[model samples]
Target: MGTGANCVQSPYHVTGSTWQTTSTHFRKQHTPHSLMFVCFSVGWVQGSTDFGVGFNLALDYGLASVYLENGTTVDIAKVEGGQVYKAAMRLNDNNIGMINGRTTYSRSEQINFKQSFLDNYIYSPNRLGGDGNGNNARSRALSLMLKALKTATESYLDSKISNAEVVVPFPASESYLHDLRQAVASVSLHMPMSAQPPTGIIAARAHGMYGKCFDDLDLQGHDKSMKNDPEQLILTIDYSRAALTALLVDEECGVFENRRVIHDTRLGLNGLHQLGSITATDLLETALRNITQLPLDDGNGAGLKYISNLVIIGESAGDPRLHDTLRRVLSEQLEPVTTVKSGFSPPIDPVFAASRGVAWDCWDRMNFQVNE
Candidate 1:
């Protein structure tokens, strides 16, 4: 049910017809060829403190990525012998068996229960654990995935994991957030509990603003004039499954101060038959107009603030055709007044943006104790 060249049912030890769980240490007992995974714990030494981790696990994307950071270095952990993890997991009755990236359970009926946790989440929210989800199997799967992430992280890093700041791709249900925290604890991993929960993708985008990736070279159509401005409005486009959302944010000096969702619609996704990516481009144009016309810091519409940077993110945000179209369209719309500098550089922007951004956020907060 997996795609890797070595994909197979996960391996579990058998003790005279009885099943016994295995640990990461079990990998060293066999040669690399005989083993289904890489022995990540081989040469590394454990560190003094737990690590700061950022988890970008949007089940809709069908995969998860963990960005674990120490003080100076960041490790994109290798789970199931890969950096990106499959969202698939094997189930045993109502119990979660070996997860895709962590360990594998070699059982005949593993495929019978092989399922995507996120897919289950959509159809039956409760069965995945808490909030009427009885067995907590879904939450257990999540916790095991977290364990896979942490073990994978520790495999490369020298430190143990403290916890992670789970970045919700969008505003999820209260039960969803509740299960997220609960899942963290189930693995002995920690996520600081608080009255306020992690924000939507907006917060991820905002935190991304402070990452080193925001260097001038990565900024498209960056204007020298706007460089000195104390505050600038930013228009961020988050596209997924062809659906797109335009967000407006106030960047005060280097800080993201105020934000608003200007447009949320599936107009962008309706472009399957449209000519030359017209529908998606039009929706973006509408979003741009909405952001530029909004009231500035004073809440007065008398003074309009245009967007300085136009950033696009998501799994499918890497379409070269879309990139060319957006650049050309945005340039046409705002060239004379202000260049909407784009942050839509392919593969990297869409894939690593959220994980890396939130990792930096986790790192900073761990070091400085900032309010989340």
Candidate 2:
């Protein structure tokens, strides 16, 4: 079971007949589960005035059990209404005030909750060797889970089976899978290994939870552009021109300091300005860096040499200003890095030439790394 923020609690009605008596009687008969409890606190501060509110919530799932009798076993999983219960405790004086001709609002909020369930029923044989409390708890939990799984399996099989194999599936991160394998091995050595080897199921899921985010961006589209025109330089710029424009208007007029107006236009202008200058430069530099450091390799370093000089490159090929900067830099600094082939045959796509020229010009303007 895991503990987190969202927890359910019982509802209360203030204007009800004999509500207090009913609440008391209900509490007496129902034993609350400590695991499924939540506490929340809220507070607000304005100037010197402070106000606060707090509450506790609890949830309970009905119990289930397995019993062995007459050489037979029975197991059941039953849950209650799962109705949430809540109680509020308040200590505050509500008040509002302004400070420094501006409004200041502050509030504090907190919630803590834990789950009440023994969800896992399998234990790994491997254990970390350490006296640390964390490690001990983990080892103990694993043992319990394994024991539970064994019992469940024996009950399910309905045979006089003293040992049965169980397989645990884990995602395919190499490091994690290795660790799990070791843990299982350790467990097997401690306990009798099943006559037949237990299966280890590796999930086919990809690494990195955010892999979908990259896929959603559709970066593959850029790959085609890269192949069509290797060395296609790209640059992106955001001037925050809109924000600057708004600020300019504000400065000219008396409404320059208006909070609402400033807040609305400030973000747009700031973003634009950043995109035009810093963002543009960043894109150019990234492309250049990638070009110089191509042929990336995996842990084995097997394919590095094969693709080392197959020059297919691109950068943030977007803005003309940024492209020009890159061009100047290349002409000055990169000229000495490699011998330029004279009378070279151009690629079918002429755009690559324009891309190279732009990058070279940009590089030259800044004297290529001298001012970098």
RMSD after CA superposition, every candidate? 17.2, 30.6
As a whole number from 0 to 100, the lDDT of residue 166 in candidate 1 is 53
Every model's TM-score: 0.52, 0.18
lDDT digits (tens) for residues 303-325 of candidate 2: 22211011111111233553464
* Candidate number achieving the greatest TM-score relative to the actual structure: 1
Alpha-carbon RMSD, candidate 1 = 17.2
In candidate 2, what residue range of length 10 has the lowest lDDT sum? 197-206
Candidate lDDT (C-alpha), each: 0.39, 0.21
Q: Tell me which residue pairs clash in candidate 1.
A: 10-104, 10-105, 10-106, 11-104, 126-133, 128-138
Question: Model 2, clash count?
Answer: 45
